[model samples]
Target: MVRNEQRKLTATYLNGVGMAVLGVGGFAPVVSMTLSGPTSSIVPVLVFGCILASSGLHLLARQTLGGLEE
Candidate 1:
């Protein structure tokens, strides 16, 4: 039981880290570029889309696992 709890904690931590990276690394640059000029419009959209997609995947995976636990 302890081992299982540790594994779940680790999974949650990793998911949070992945989200942070996607939010910062993936979208921050595009946002900065957009603020500087109009040429970066599409870039921010693309990056934001990617971040959303990835975060969705992570949420789905977590939900699936939680369902399995029931």
Candidate 2:
């Protein structure tokens, strides 16, 4: 049980790092494109990035909370 707990903690931390990278790395290109492209084209890219980041965070939170509960 303790080993499992440790594993879960590690997974949660990794998930957080992945989410951070996804947010920054994923949005970097969108930010660049928005600056160079038309407003209409950039809007969708920004919205999609926002959605992706939020969902990743939600999943990360769920994983962390589940580990805590266990």
Please state every model's RMSD to the true fold in angstroms.
Answer: 3.4, 4.2
| Regions of model 2 farther than 4 Å from truth | 36-70
Candidate 1 residue-wise lDDT, 1-70, digit = tens:
6656765776677587767768776867767776876564577677777687668757755864563342
lDDT of each: 0.68, 0.66
User: lDDT per residue, candidate 2, 14-56, as tens digits?
Assistant: 6776666566656665686678875465666665766676677
What's the C-alpha lDDT at position 15 in model 1? 80
- On the 0 to 100 scale, the lDDT of residue 27 in model 1 is 69
